[model samples]
Target: MVSGSNGDGVRVPSASFSRLSATNVLFGWTWPQLAVGGVGLVLLVIGGAAGFNLPVMLVGVLVMAYGLVRFQGLSLLAWTYVWFTWRSRLREGSNVWSSSPLETGRTVGVLGVWSQVEDRAQVVEGESVDVVGTPWRDACYLYDPDKRQATAVLTLKVEEWSLSTNARKRDRAMALNNLTMTLASTPGVVELKETSLLMPTSAPVPPDLDDPDMPSWARGDLAELWAMPEIATPLANVSWVSVSVNVDRLSTRSRNMDRLTERNRVGVLLGDIVQNVVAPALVECGGQHGSIRWCSVDELRDMIRCVSDPAHASSQRKVRRGEPTLSYCEESADGEYVTLESCVARSWWVTQWPDRPVPAGWTRDILQGDRMIALTHIWRPLSMAESEKDLANKQSSMLQRSRLADQKRLSRDERRERREQAQREAEQDANWPDTDHQGYITLFAPDKSRLDDLERGLRMETGKYHLTLNGLTGQQRKALATVLPLGV
Candidate 1:
């Protein structure tokens, strides 16, 4: 595999097999599975001691094996909890109880007929007079009454580039490295919660029969070519990046403040991050960053409608519809645990990360599939002191594990490897910056059949990078919001 240097000058492999060790086997089993298996094993032992019938002993063994193999008891438990919660909501007969964090926050009711200000220069004046709260250059800002927080969604335009030439490839790689470093260093740049890259399934090109440059003979050929169903036409791809910044967490004030004050403060912070950090970082990376626009109430409603109701998407009727004033979303099904959506969506949690070094663009495959997918990376910043303490505790835990492994006569290689890893982590704690990150990917489809097809494609894509994804069964609604740019 080809190798390249990252911002830290570390040699990164283009692709490689992930590291496999004994610890992986233990980690593969969830706690619930382990507990179930343990109970089954105890039953088997008790049955054997009492000289119980062979059938009873066989049943116990089978239960133990099933628990070890399926590891689905936990998911079932989670679904049960969701079922009870839904029942309670039904009993209460109030919409106040919600599973989604997006709906739990303060209700401003629905503001109608919000409009986007196309001219960047008029943003400030627009906010002061006509706009609802604080007007951002690119994004719309809203105050969440429940959380006392301000949320903004910035739409960034991703510019496409060619990498066919070696020189172009090298330059792009360097640009990506620089962008990565910039993001890592930027303050208040927490997480990229969700990114949506959409490409139309089919595009049709009409023949220009009236063009004077075209010969009469060529016109018939062009018309025939345009009519051919076998030919594929290319369409422009659109991408949106959703990010959430915690206004309450960023504020210095201890007491509750006015909604307008909170809105303005959060708005300024979002603008600075976009302009000073995101925009400059993209420019250095041989790419251009677009204006950071806020999603107007109308825009938000349209988005929800498009995602929830696929008919609107397929018919393309909603494309030209002017943004509506207010929008509300409701899930179509409950308790079955698979189809959870304001429209229809399936959420997946990243169960495993690549264990070995991979190219910087390892995630590119995620966007290549035919289905609409949203990938989210949630980063939680850790203070230097907190990181150091956490590392020290981990080191202590590793040492104890190593000792236990030695006493149990486990593989010497595995024990030695654990010691080495602990040592490396100690060195890293002392030298490298600390950041905790979580990632989620959500797949949206029009129906169950489409969702199933997309899920298979996604699994194949993720497998290529040595990553693992597990469906977030009962937590689909929560996971969906978490993956969206709506700072839940």
Candidate 2:
């Protein structure tokens, strides 16, 4: 975190996560680019050694061009991977998933058996959050037999920070940073996911209109104000944090145990981590005392149901474990968005973060809007050895880049990156674990036209902070998986 006094002399804490790696693996080229360019160079050298054959040299030039050219921030080879992946999905019919309606003509409302995604061993594919077991009351986990990992979801109710004093904000930020450090030091924690779900809620109870002295005109106007659409659909934001532990990483003894025994072991370990590490750290970070708890089996099911089918989000309906969460999900005919039952959804990759330092709560404006949206941050912690190696590579890359450019001048982006790297170095010196994170934004609408309008407005709003949102086309389903509170 970067803490400093603002123009008003209020000390506020701000932060910017590291973007995609800019370090060069070789001569200012990433691994993929370097490999492609190296092959081309080899071809050119062979042609030169063979008396400069024109055809061979031409092929070499074309290969080099292919390596250097980029389209939509991806090279030709990278695009090829995307194309094949999408094509395979199409062939496998993975893009469209529909559940047959029951006798009552209603589809399942909670995730359950789906033969299409089920493997021979009955494991659900692609970030499925199906709960495999609830070892005890108020403690449950989503287990992946293949990965031998179990993830526990916890509901976190943090203290409100809006309009809080500067000291409180600073303290909150520091406490959060401390929690991060604690997580980094803890072993067997493979990933940490924080998700915020913003939904439209029913209007709150209005003041009693039975006043004896109230004039008719005043009462009429007050009733109209309270009945406004925005007021009726007030925004409600819910936050969830999921921690994934590698069962095998925790105990090798599980390798010889049966699946049930292994799951039980994982459950016990997860409970311990939540009670000892996560719960305490969250409490210290201004979270309400006793407000953090592991989701029971039913709560987890309902959470997934609500996220998958937002129309049911405000209904407070009970979701059974044996029903599918989504009824009918398919990519739009234009491939611009996805339709999940009644809601039209679109997702974006947060390609850029604000270059200028902003407060830790800078996202309030975007998140507190009337529209329903979900912003997810997935963090993968780096071990100390891995952190040192990355830092060394970044330093080397920057030094080489400077040498290649004019000594006295640097580009604006270069300067900003240099400054950011300096801060990272300081963080490392302070034993703060380096983390790689990806940000995703998913927006929901009742229809395609509304979704389009929301997208346009959000683009403008995010641009104010120099943020970049790249629409995830042809991959909406996969991108949506990351933003869901499933620890994807």
Candidate 3:
């Protein structure tokens, strides 16, 4: 493997040792483009046969070029329209109350204390329900009140280890390979809806640091730490991996089944997956499964209240404000998104993917930094046929762009970029067998100044992989919601 120096002068393994060739053509013109070109050709021939009318021939030529250049855009538009129409028709035909159960469903309320919820069913009065009985069980479930579909969510902590060295690199690779295999074996059994790794800023002292029994010297040090700027303040590296799965497929129950029965069934399935699949996988990766529990109603309510009103969260003097009194949020001027709790966060979408093949655990650096960060990955499964079609379309687009670059006699940098993109696409077609993946990273800090520092750290860390992150802007709240284990 080739090694390169990072901004800190630390030697890190390069993404790939050898460059892949991008001269091969994997796909040609798509069917839609061909059909449009055929029509344009016919029009051009007719105009020529009718004494070569300049306007008609010129229109035909323009139409042909448009069909060729904007083929992907037009095709995507058509596909989107067809998909919406089909979904609308299905909703109309079904007796279901809403188009999507996730959007309209009421949250599955959790009762009892955090310590009381366990992996096993808890017998209470006349009903038996599995409780999410652990402090680490930061998962929440959303229940469709109408359809009775239950979606269970659990956010497990992610552990970060060094990957720059050879031994650590090998370990990272094995862990990732094992994870991929485990996920693939599950088939349609469970869905890894979202995986988030967050590193929020650490508090200077424990919540109980104000005890009178504390020594004066220790108290002085604690106070100094607290007074330090967030950038200088040590960060608590916490990584959370949230997984969401639908519970309807776990059993052969009818759609009219009782809500309690459905909830119990889902709870059992989620617990089993955690104990059997998820926990084992983490153990194999040299990490322990921290907590696995369904999210409580109180926690969900608190989150909703905080997101809705930042003032309630930011207020120091707590007056009784009905339910969800302990709010934590800071809203932007427009009030679309909020700085949640003590963390000033901004979500980022991966705009530019790495052109080269990086080590499997390259994300370790991104997750482990002096500043708090959360990285979320959402994978949408696609059938084999769909994957093939999508790959073909991408290959064709890359080829078109490369040809265009050549025709335009673009600069060496531009040409190199096109070639690298094509090479990366080809590599993905050959190697990646998973579903379509979308990645988001959220950086958090105690305040705006710390947030800027965290952002800078993120940029420097991601620069090692040649990746670019663009802020989600107005969609920060939505992005944050995805990162949290809300099952929304």
- Which RMSD values do the candidates have, in order? 8.4, 4.5, 10.0
Better of 1 and 2 by lDDT: 2
lDDT rank order: 2, 1, 3
TM-score of each: 0.63, 0.86, 0.56
- In candidate 3, which residue pairs clash? 117-133, 118-133, 137-293, 139-295, 140-295, 199-372, 313-327, 313-328
Best by lDDT: 2
Clashes of each: 12, 4, 8
Candidate 2 stretches with Cα past 4 Å from truth are 6-10, 27-32, 46-58, 68-75, 102-136, 205-215, 251-260, 406-408
* Candidate models: Cα lDDT each: 0.52, 0.71, 0.50
Q: For residues 223-283, what per-residue lDDT tens digits would candidate 1 score against the true structure?
A: 8887653334332334445444455565335434455554455666665665566556555
Clashing pairs in 2: 110-323, 110-324, 110-325, 111-325
Taking the tens digit of each residue's C-alpha lDDT, what string does model 3 give over 1-488? 23555556545445442222222223244576677777878889888999998788888887677555532223433444544654553455321111223422332223211111211212111122334422223344554343334444443444455524555545544554456545544533434554544332323344446789999889988777767655344444433344445455554334333544545556555556566776666655545355433444444454333333333333323332232322233335332234654446677767555656675556767766555566776655444455456556655656576676665767654565556546546645655434546677876666777777777777887887777665644445556656654444
Query: Highest TM-score, which number?
Result: 2
Segments in model 3 whose C-alpha atoms lie over 4 Å from true places = 1-140, 144-150, 157-160, 163-172, 185-190, 193-234, 246-260, 289-322, 325-344, 368-370, 381-432, 445-457
At residue 20, what lDDT does model 1 achieve?
28
Candidate 1 regions exceeding 4 Å error are 1-135, 144-148, 161-190, 201-205, 208-236, 251-260, 285-295, 309-343, 407-431
